[model samples]
Target: MFDKVLVANRGEIAVRVIRACKDLGIGTVAVYSEADKHGGHVRFADEAYNVGPARAADSYLDHEAIIETAKQAGADAIHPGYGFLAENAEFAGKVESTDGVVWVGPSSDAMEQLGEKTKARAVMSDADVPIVPGTDPIEEPDAVRTFAEEHGYPIAIKAEGGGGGRGMKIVREESEIEEQLESAKREGEAYFDNDSVYLERYIENPRHIEVQVIADEHGNVRHLGERDCSLQRRHQKVIEEGPSSALSEGLREEILEAARRGVDAAGYYNAGTVEFLVEEDPDRAPGERLDDDTDFYFLEVNTRIQVEHTVTEEITGIDIVKWQLRVAAGDEIGFAQSDVAFDGHAMEFRINAENAAEDFAPATGGTLETYDPPGGIGVRMDDALRQGDDLVTDYDSMVAKLIVHGSDREECLARSRRALAEYDIEGIPTIIPFHRLMLTDGPFVDGTHHTKYLDEDLDTERIEEAQAKWGTDGEAAASGGDGTTTQELTIEVDGKRFDVKLENPGLPTNGAGQQAAGGGGAGGGTTSASGGSGGDQAATLEGQQVTAEMQGTILEVNVEEGDEVASGDVICVLEAMKMENDVVAPSGGTVTHVAVSSGDSVDMGDTLLALE
Candidate 1:
């Protein structure tokens, strides 16, 4: 057991680690960006410190600031709760170098070895783990062209240091080889600071599966079974489940064991995931049984806690984070591989602040008004936002996760539907409707859905209907749901702390975003309120408004006032979170008012142009 642990992340995963540390009677320290000073995770932790500004690069990713905070808090260990610096091998090495400071993950050397895609592929191949046909350290477009010539079109060019499909590009033709390869390498360098890439034979219609393996310094390794992360969009996992409905009993055991072997080969310890792409043969029928011949290719290794670890925890009855702390403290895995038992089916739905009806674009400048999550016998909601918390546009869009368990996959689907319907959020768009739509989807219910299901086969109209039916409308605005106003009053008591009971204080303070004091240090994120777009707005005829569909910063403006344009023509481009979205003209007409410029920031429903 550690004396104190500092969590170097934000949102739900940070809160999860804090809770686990509390259960172990370990003191906890939380680091937050100025944007997350008043965040739920900060409030829940025993002590909190401000790292930097709202931007993650200056805050959560600022290793020196985090290290300073950890030393100041006297934390013996730092638990990075997925994302941010969770898998940064350099940060881990720094923590390891510091006296009495432990990094709750695999050794930094192991992380560096496994973090690179090409190296991990070679290790897995030597360990007898199946790997996709690929090349290592591809430096030229000719290599991509050569690989594509042999593997046929649709080859995957992936960054050596990237994951989550960030620095990956697909080449479907020989003419695209040169451009796509360079683009992949550029993205790799821009995001991961590595300009290296590899080429792989793209497996069409594959189910994204990952095996969770926990290891100890004493050389004990255990596999907590596999998670079917097949349901995805843009290569990002959406719905994840344990004990995939598609895998046969034999295939399941094989994949799980292979995962352990690969980790063991890497000298990996603590929690890690080995992702695989399980090929769904087109010739096979939807319900066709899989045999030992079923093929699953190695994807990549996540060297830290995963976003979907909750589903594995639900089925395996193990606290993976707690074990990470214990393992880092020089404790051996008490249970052997045989003692690890899995039961039932568990599924986790990522409740992200994105509009599924509009291609799952990230939503910004929104608040969690109602903020009600589902609760029941088999349901677990992991989140870190209070009702009045504004959406932090600085990092990932995932705000919460809903995990459900049942005796089997069938019951799990049913329970998930019930739980999703009970979940409520307001002030911004969400992908809950998409998750709810999947409950009735044939491929998903039957467990025949592939990784490209959402991108290739989903029904957009049906998703809109679900969103209109189940989603809270404009009436469910902020804490002032009645359409009034809110006031903030800060007071000090006993020179110790602060607490907010924002029931009533005075009149609203216009649109200025301010910081108030609270128990965790400072209050909620820096937010600037825009005037509301009330009343019935015109949607047709000569006067049509091209309003911002979400909160974002304008990247470019394509039209000026009095310019004639056609419907769907790009009016402006808005960048929200990390995604770029196009705002287009509603109908063909003359632009009457150009309300924004390229550098102007806008919120949801803020008019960018008016066509007459």
Candidate 2:
């Protein structure tokens, strides 16, 4: 019941919080960076403030600036959307200390307890929640080795502060332990600022299932079913479905009850998720399955609203954000555990502006020229991006989430297919085609996929087959030529080659459409008497390096001195986009030296190490 709340994040989740606040008649304040001045979230806020420069370090993540914004806006509380400061215990503590500014998340003590994986596991185990067998925080490298020996090789060294699969390494044998340990420590320190890591018995072929728990100041906690986030790539969840198809009624009850107990034990409040790694083994003989009984082990506890909360809302009809505000206002748990019901089935696919063929690398581009999200009964698209908005490289690549609700898993799959097919976006590469393939896959259709599904169950052959269906050169080139003339050039939309022919051989009289093909002359060699037929426009093309489309730093360069590269051998990694897009050999021939380095800024199409 806050009169106003400050949303301390950006992108879709920030917009989501703002909408929820509006519905409750609560005023909302948005903080934005210079880059996000025209962002969807900024426009949606009741009032907005310019926090800092476009860089996240100077804007969204600046704690003092955020606090000051909240104070200036007279916000009664702050909602830290997932990511950035959402799980920052110090930020939560700061908000709590500031009079009249309540922190609408788990208490700092609970975050600290759950932030450390070892502590969380211990706490869950004490509450009778099943957990993977692993040593609680080893103090030395030798201790890590000792745990590895007992747990049978192939253990995972995980950072106590790790969340997004970062700060983790899998050691398959004794020899690789030391190297993996150091790597894990380094990543932990870099990402979480905590070099401390612990070992866990790596569960091969496990399901990522998590139960959402909401508690109130009255000490009442309730379990809101669970979400099966098994479909993933590179340890990041790509698809999530509610009420895991793998769990039986008896097992589901046990896991839900266990999660409730853990929340209660941790003295938790507001919304949180207790994630577990469920062992997916169907080959074991009856009564010989240790995994069947204690399969779901505590992985970590998310101390705030999850990105996939929409999936839960789609099926349950619960407003988790409303609950957060209400809880902050001293409201008791609105509904008892029994009041919660699993209506149908819900699934969420994260639609990131990333190229799936290139390992789900992030992509950057300007506002979509065409932004059409699929919407119908049982389908919902949550996004804060729009056409013409600059898709900067300074933030997370996920632009939206495609969610579907159906009466059953099959219906959900069907809906997912329809939703993905209906979704259309232009300007940047997306994982839509990849998700479309996932929905049609057999293992996924049969509900047999696990956390390792993307790695183990993915049909690379089928993806290649699908890619072939669209014709090679990946999805980017698949769109091909639409047979439209933007300037004086005619782009080949359907052709396999990037043959841009000039239909009208003349200088571009207007600033509209794609780049003009051929030289800016009325006829080849017939330079118009007007100096250069196209005036200064042609002069601007000289000595331009094609920058990356997104915001990741560069990682590699495939082209070298006079080396011939086909149209698609990766030229260099445009790290800005958090993806490695090949500055493909735009044309076949020898490389004339790469213009960019291993680390350089690449915009949409600045000549990246050009082709001769």
Best by lDDT: 1
Which tens-of-lDDT digit does each residue in 305-367 have in candidate 1?
A: 999999999999999988888898889988988888889999999998877665676765577
Report the C-alpha lDDT of model 2 over 1-612, residue by residue, as the tens digit.
Answer: 799999998889999999999999999999999978888998899999999997676788899999988999899899998998999898888888998899989888889889889899888888888888877665566887788667787788988999767778888877887878876776666567788888888989887889998999898998888998888876788888997887777778778888889999999999999888877875633323233365577889999999999888987889999999899889887677778878899999998876676556565444576688999999987899887666765777788999999998778888888888788786666778788887777677767776777876675777645532322222343333333232123456667546343433233322233344553522345222111222243234332223444444455576676777676576764544322244454446666445556545433434455345
Report lDDT (Cα) of residue 469, candidate 2: 39
Candidate 1 local Cα displacement, residue 449, angstroms: 0.5
Name the 10 consecutive residues with the lowest summed lDDT in model 1.
Answer: 526-535
RMSD of each: 10.5, 8.1
CA lDDT, candidate 1, residue 577: 50
Q: Relative to the unseen true structure, what is the C-alpha lDDT of residue 112 in candidate 2, on a scale of 0 to 100? A: 85
The superposed Cα distance between candidate 2 and the true structure at residue 169, in angstroms, equals 0.3
